[model samples]
Target: MPGETVQPTPPGPAPVPVPGTLVVDTSRGDRLGEFRGAAGPYWSLRAVCGGVEWEAEPGAVRRATRKERLHAEIERWNARSRGEVL
Candidate 1:
């Protein structure tokens, strides 16, 4: 093993979602965010309430369920009301 070479694993294919579509990144604790676009090998997602974007692996991202979408909308509204997001 001393002279053995190692190889890096390629990123897995992720489902592509339209921009502005709500999605859930299960790998990120089910964080709800809006799909921005592809970020190299990862997908770009930002909080529905508006905040810094985070890169999620394609395999970990999926369209938000109806319930999740509603919840995210409600969270956005709550943030807006509290002046935490505009």
Candidate 2:
């Protein structure tokens, strides 16, 4: 292999996080949501209380904190008690 030129490897696609992942979206006032997979160019997220879903840029989201998770759970419980959610 004398005088052979080395070719550069091409970059791969972006890594996407899986579903059921708890995250906080700073673009939405740091609101908490669960990752539900890709939504076009953005990522789809569902509310922790099983409410409406929203789309967000992956860069604007991060893993949610323990405290945030607890609070969201409580909110869901309270909503259930009031029959707001099943």
Candidate 3:
């Protein structure tokens, strides 16, 4: 133990952004905030849905759906809008 070097503990995982809180995107990454317009474009408000807490981007966010049905819907909409039969 006399000559042994005790290495310092490495930093832990970053904190989870709190729900209902805004965060700023610093060069070091996200930090908590109570209001918007104080953060950069890469930053966003934190939220929780379906029992999971996560950061959300601006605008509409929806639950993930099956790919086949999702693609089919898109195709149907495109066809209808183009006046083509589906």
Candidate 4:
């Protein structure tokens, strides 16, 4: 123990993105939103520009495509730019 290097604790499985992370729900035309955790039997996602969160099947949701992500970001920027969102 004196000379042996202590092995760092191995991290758990890849972490699930926390709530408010941008994601795309492929089940519904690949709509983009922020991950809002699970809702009963489904996962919940909220629009990037802010809105009522919606329930979606976990299998149907995934990390957003590059294009989709950029689109959502731009939309948010525009909303903020227009003072629609704070």
Candidate number of the best lDDT: 1
Instruction: Tell me, by TM-score, which candidate is best.
Output: 1
Model 3, 1-86: lDDT tens per residue? 79999999996534444443433323224322222221433234332111223344432222223553355456557777888743
lDDT of each: 0.87, 0.85, 0.39, 0.80
Task: Sort all candidates by TM-score, best to worst.
Answer: 1, 4, 2, 3
Would you list the clashing residue pairs of candidate 2?
Answer: none
Which tens-of-lDDT digit does each residue in 1-86 have in candidate 1?
A: 89999999997666588899999899989888999999788999988877799998988888889999889888888887888835
Error of 4 at 45 (Å): 0.6
Clashes of each: 0, 0, 0, 0
Question: Model 2 segments beyond 4 Å from truth?
Answer: 1-15
TM-score of 4: 0.72
Cα error, candidate 3, residue 67 (Å): 46
lDDT of 2 by residue, 1-86 (tens): 99999999985554677788789889999989989999788989998878788999887888888998889889889988989853
Candidate RMSDs in Å, in order, are 8.1, 5.5, 13.7, 6.7
lDDT of 4 by residue, 5-86 (tens): 8889985533466887788888889788899887666888888978898998776777877887788889989998899953
lDDT of 4 at 18: 85
